[model samples]
Target: MSDIDPGQARPPRRVRVDLPGRAYDILIGAGLVDAAGSILAERLPDARLAIVTDETVAALHLDRLTASLDAAGIAHAVVTVPPGETSKSFRQLEHVVDAILAGRFERGDAVLAFGGGVVGDLAGFAAAIVRRGMRFVQMPTTLLAQVDSSVGGKTGINSPRGKNLVGAFHQPDLVLADTSVLDTLVPREFAAGYAEVVKYGLIDRPEFFDWLEWKRAPIFAGGPERAEAIAASCEAKAAVVIADEREAGERALLNLGHTFGHAIEAAVAFDPARLVHGEAVSIGMAQAHRFSARLGLCPGQDATRVEAHLKAAGLPTRLSEVPGAAIAREVLMAGIAQDKKVKRGRLTFILTRGIGRSFIAADVDAAQIDEFLAEELAG
Candidate 1:
């Protein structure tokens, strides 16, 4: 329940997201999952919980979590869905919600999302819609979830139109990011996860981006550097969310690469075989830099540097690099048009003037995007 672990290179760090009347803490470090039951028992005494995880995660880590709950005298039931983006759909959401209801869990009971982004989104959305907004907890077990998805509580299921087209703004009551769990990930997954960390730097914390450029190796090696990066990303997001909880203004900055990323996802039909969220975001971020260069808003060297870093990390930096993702100009345009960022038939893009100077370019010309996609597709 405390933020100390002498065995760790650095003591666990905590970031608070202060929402109006509903503040929550994001705990990032090596042992949060193992300590979750004690943490929860202290935070929400006698509250029942339904643990929602994906099959892959449940197989790998659920037993330890259940053991923790038992040690703390807490009651919990586990519900697991398939691992992947497909699980973040209405069908899976219904299954999760029904499982919770059938388990006789009440509104006061928390739905603990104990996996990566898919489980977090699906389970969080379930918790949001069930019992007219039940309490939810985030026990993120992956690098991607630990840094980005787990903190903000932007939970949702996907729609036929696009990725995250259907979702709700439901903040979590608590977030436990267990960095040790990330050690289980293969290099590709870890690299993909690192993309989100870069995103925070690319957002407004330009200094953080500069830090990552030098410290990426240690960050990936996992220790104090990993903890520091996660804590910083959470702090950065908490500031934006506290200022604009609903993405009505500055929070839109958080979607720096999402517009283009989601378009790529929509075109690929959200296939993990082709690309995952972070990989799409990697390509999208590089594309954003390149697109800005094309628009004469940024220097080409900046775009090249971004692409070089992503490529070195094994992330796709160009549209051509995304496996099995050859999106046509019209299809790309259509997907962008249907993106969540599009408001009233106008498009919003996060373009950069330099590596860390990203700004919202509202009502960007659709023809320009089309022309860019045409060139992007050609390459």
Candidate 2:
């Protein structure tokens, strides 16, 4: 249902990947996986590749990817992981390593993460550890991975302590995004992914958010505008990653909604039955907007507008609606404390001053956060 009109011709959107020496391109278009062999061959050269994917994506598109690699004369092995955040574990990663060893993958061989964010994170982490670091390619199928996780190269597994607690900065050698796979996403998953697409607009691109406001329905329904939106979002993310590859500075800005989002995820143990990543981000962003308004960064109207837009996009926008709102503030703070941005035992929060303007605040008072949580929990 993508909007590519056979009548109109447009060059594929290309974003210069982040790492300087590791610079690559993010190829976005339809039927790209079918054309992936040439792309991978050029980027990877003679590296033997391991295709790490999920059961769902493997069933649908693994053959096409394998066929493409075969035609390119690239030796490859397919490794499938269970499709979920739960699969991002030490045990699962160990299993992948075993598969790599059993398949005789060499030290120079690369791992191809061929699914959504989970596959990207899990496989990227495995690539980082396999023989103490091998190359990896990100083939993100979901919009969330393409827009946020894949471009950044922050690969990790979740811990009971917090999400992404154990990870590394392993940039991919290349990223091939065949937007066509989105066609197979169920309505709920598609809507969940949109939450991440909308975050870039709220965090740094107010104009983009306005553009999205006008195009949400067409995007949801699948049109050319949808493809354009995906390309634009990835471009924005890629530029940010290039400027701050390791997330030591401007990269933290990308976590605008994720701090709250990750906590929501922790509160739910990352069960899709309860919540998905984008849905948590949606609710998190709405709450952060309210907190920002209360801190006098923006008017309350901004929070209302954010809430309206997320709800319209089929995302949850309330904390109380979550099952654990009644839980102690300390529990949520504990999760916030585990954030990678923490320094000297103090939490550094990314707060928005207005749409498209955000700043880091290590001096933000805990009293203010408690007050915000009280209201968020009650209301």
TM-score for each candidate, following the candidate numbering: 0.93, 0.91
Please, what's the RMSD in Å of model 2?
2.7
Candidate 2 lowest-lDDT run of ten: 1-10
Off by over 4 Å in 1: 1-6
Error of 1 at 43 (Å): 1.6
lDDT of 2: 0.81
lDDT tens digits, residues 1-379, model 2?
A: 1233454234556777657788777877776777788777887798999889999999988888888889889999988988887898988989998998888887788999999998999999999888889988888988777777767778989787657789888888888777777889987788888988887888789899999989999888766677788888888888788888766788777787788887777667677778888888888788778888898997788788888988998888987666543556677776777766778876777788776666677667767777787777766
Most TM-score-accurate candidate: 1
RMSD (Cα, Å) for all candidates, in order, is 2.4, 2.7
Error of 2 at 159 (Å): 3.5
> Largest lDDT belongs to which candidate?
1
Query: What are the lDDT figures for the candidates, one per model?
Result: 0.85, 0.81
